[model samples]
Target: MALKMARDDLTEFLAAEFPQVAQDFVIEDVAENRIRVRLATQDRHLRPGGTVSGPSMFALADVGVYLAILAMIGPKALAVTTNCSIDFMRKPAAGADLIAECRLLKLGRVLAVGEVLMMSEGGDAPVARASLTYSIPPE
Candidate 1:
């Protein structure tokens, strides 16, 4: 399906709906079935070893998939994650931003499945991978 929300639209939706952490993320790119999101890493997102925390990476994956779905289906705030499985493959680069490349694997009427590959900005290997399922709300 064609995207219903572009980067600007998604950015605005996030800022308006989730102001708390909206500034932490950036909608870098949006396309037919995929999105690239960046997490502007800060002190709060890091762990004791100066690497991005697991929870912070998970948040990036979750938000990445959520935005990709909204890009295809419009801003459906009610759409929620039903399940997620994330594997932290490696420690993120110290003090570097993180990026999530998300692809929508399936977009059904009531459900959507997406996969996210998380990486440290400018790094070669993936730091984490996640599979997520979201429940789309009824119209």
Candidate 2:
């Protein structure tokens, strides 16, 4: 399937619909079935031990899938995450930005499913993995 929305379109949509977090993420790449996003690392994203916090990582995974869905379906602001399961496999680097590589596994009339592989800027292995399901609003 072809991408219905481009990177700049997605960015503009995010800024208009979710301005609070529009600057926290960057659209690294967007293709037919995959979308890559980067999270800007900052002190607020770190935990007590100077590691990226789980909630911060979760946000990456969530937004990754959300955008992946929109990439194919266009900017459907009402599409919402229904379920998410994330596993942190390793600690993220203290100051390195986190990257989320998300792929759409299924996109149905009412629901969409995607998986995200998250890693630190230049890490060799994945730091976290997540499976997310979203409920798409009817047209």
Predicted structure with the largest TM-score when compared to the true one: 1
The sequence of per-residue lDDT tens digits that candidate 1 reaches over residues 1-139 is 6889999999999999999999999999999989999999999999998999989998999999999999999999999999999998988999999999999999999999999999898999999999999999999
lDDT of each: 0.96, 0.94
Report how far residue 27 has shifted in candidate 2, in Å: 0.3
Candidate 1 clash total?
Answer: 0
Q: Which stretches of candidate 2 lie over 4 Å from their true place?
A: none
Q: Per-residue lDDT of 1-139 in model 2, one digit per residue for the tens? A: 7899999999999999999998999999999889999999889999998889999999999999999999999989999999999989999988899999999999999999999999999999999999999999999
In order of appearance, the predictions have TM-scores of 0.99, 0.98
- Candidate 1: RMSD to truth: 0.5
Task: Tell me each candidate's RMSD, in Å, in order.
Answer: 0.5, 0.6
lDDT of 2 at 81: 95
